[model samples]
Target: MRALRALRPVQEPPARVTRITVHRPSPPLDGLVELIWAADSYVAQAERERVLPSGAQSLVVHLGNGPLRVFTDEDAIDATEVSGAIVCGARVTPLLIDTALGPTVGVEFKPGGARPFFDLPADAITGRVVSLDALWGASAHSLRERLMETSSPRDRVRLLEDNLLRRLARSFELDAALRLSLDAFEGRDLTSVGEVNRRTGLSPKRLLALFRDEVGLSPKAFWRVRRFRSALRALDHGTLRGAAVAAEHGYFDQAHFVREFRSLAGSTPREYLAARVVGTDHVSVRR
Candidate 1:
């Protein structure tokens, strides 16, 4: 695959565009996905395909003058002149859409990376489109628009991070616990959920509940997905062999890895690598 632009967010307008901000993964977060941005004049006909990996979620903020339509396997949502937010959770199918007008700034948070921002059960979102006003208040739309209007990309990122923290403040403590457990698992195979609970000083049941609320997925599911992403990045970097990648990421073996890969990525490692070369404009995936 082509060397991805750095993980930092980029602000650049394509032809006939006013402005666009692309947010990449953070350096320490090499396993996450990239975020795309489009300007008011931006318009594209998206293919009828699912675009995100399992456990992934996206938050979109509309900053332009027009509206945009998002199509899921079952539903189509028209977010018009809605200078607000929309959250897309893990979908079994892809979203197809034809943009009419306006600029849309979005943040694509990968499986593990997005856990801290949401404090609801992962399954709570199935394949549904929700407005920011539905989650936050009416003022949320205007606030998001103002932040997106910031001229500086750095300022925009800071604003985004701040907003994320604010929205997830109730779940911050749970995120802290999860981060601690994740760090404990680094450089070693992940142990049982009970161990994670012990390390975090939370009961296993409480941990699961908190994790599901804050991160959207159960802790075990989050761990598995995060490990999968770790393996994917290693393979993407050409630093780990398939068998070794599975072992290193806490999979029982290559078979386990392949199963999880197929379930989450819809392909095997080799096939995913092959497709990765062709879909350079978007995020990487492992089948």
Candidate 2:
């Protein structure tokens, strides 16, 4: 048998211009964190891009000149400046972000897996880019300061892992029902959310409430996100996109898939593919 690989590089910044490295946590953390990534580079001009939803939560620490700016939508006009670090809540909408002026480190937490690390309910932050200081308080600033002192990307990544380990809530535990539902859904059930609900042994209302608290998305929304991820992966891999691909990913048909794509991604499938930055979910948009 072939040896198993740990972290797979999802995106490689344009060669020579910028470099980004992604690492997967080992063991316990692996169950929650999908990956830890760091990027260091400087662009003479401001770069803006739209980051598509991945059905996950993110915590990013910026260690550079200017603060991170998140735009309201695809227009890229209205914006909010978020200094230092931010917790990007699990969302179904696209996030428009301004170019980074300095080095940055971030963590991508698996769906419903961020509970232990956060103090509040996951749904509270949904669709919002919250300042990390709001949650971690002064410690968030101190963490960014420490990251800024480190020139080595490897060192920064290690620091992030250590901080997460220190902050991990040992007392927090996932509801047994939610855990079971996640297992079934992630196992590629490719069926209906109703089936997943039944498997959880909870009423539809009860299970939905649990999901909102833990996963930040309703069961149907979460399933749609998951299905979208699969379709995107297939399309990115050069698999021809059409009704066949849609059915393979559990969409009712090509039209059904297209509607969901527009809703979550803010663009049609073809347009997204044309603008997609290779190895990343980022789409370059005109200002």
Candidate 3:
């Protein structure tokens, strides 16, 4: 249950880390871990990046980096400094992250996937970032020390995955109804709440309560983010017009798509795409 399946990571450390490519986790942790991603010191310039919501949470490990700096808003008020490993919660809105740092690694958790390990409601940490040491105590600090000494990304991943398996909850079990709802919501384009209920046979109230407890975001909210991400994928994969991309993703209209884009991305589609840095989500913005 604790063994890693295999490694097929892309060997391009110079690129910004977007998705996991190496050291797939074992079966026991599959429902919890969606991916494992890492990045080297690709850029040294002091800059800010907009981190859009992915309807998932993450545990980020800073390997010998100074610290992870996060701002509540563009104004950078009450910024939080995270050292070692940190748990990044679900984001209902875009976030401003300090991009003036070094190499890092992270584990992206699937929707409703983090419940078993933390012994708390998923919404407790949603839209917030908490240190791993705060959650896992001495074990987190020890893991960071081991990672700081190892230079290989593979070793880091192995260590991370092994530790996660060790920390796997023995008493908790994944909700069956939530899995059906997630599949229904993610399987179709523009899946409606009613459709999800029809597929899962759960009342709207039950669905909402389940999401709040198990997944942080409500069912409808999670589906909205999923739709937004679909549009992002379409845009990334091709050179399509905004209207065309909107249609492909089942947005109500170009105007509606733009509004959602601007709301979650902190910029219009044109602006974000035009200023996008190649091979990464980081965008150039004036400080």
C-alpha-based local distance difference test score of model 3: 0.73
Model 3 is weakest, by summed lDDT over 10 consecutive residues, at 1-10
Task: State which candidate has the highest TM-score.
Answer: 2
Query: Residue 283 of model 2: what lDDT?
Result: 70
Error of 1 at 26 (Å): 12
Candidate number that wins on lDDT, 1 or 2: 2
Error of 3 at 130 (Å): 0.9
Instruction: Give all TM-scores, in the order shown.
Output: 0.63, 0.90, 0.87
Candidate 2 Cα misplacement greater than 4 A, ranges: 1-16, 42-46, 169-173, 187-189
Lowest-sum lDDT 10-residue window in model 1: 278-287
Instruction: Name the lDDT value of residue 283 in candidate 3.
Output: 57
Clashing residue pairs, candidate 1? 40-102, 40-103, 50-94, 118-214, 119-213, 119-214, 120-213, 122-216, 267-287, 268-287
lDDT of 3 by residue, 1-287 (tens): 01112244333335443322345456888767876655544452237777678887778888755888888887675678888888877766875777766667778788888877677888888889899998889988998898878777677777778778878845344688988888888774534789899888999999999998888898878888888877876776676778998787777889999999888888888887766654444555556
Cα lDDT tens digits for candidate 2, 1-287 = 00012243233344324456677888678878888877766342236777788777888888977889898876657689989999998889888888655788888888887888888889999899999999988989899999999898778989999888888745344567877887777655458878886777788898889889988988888888878888888888877677877788877788998999999888888888877666556776755
How far off is residue 166 in model 1, in Å? 7.4
Better of 2 and 3 by lDDT: 2
Q: Candidates' lDDT values, in order?
A: 0.55, 0.78, 0.73
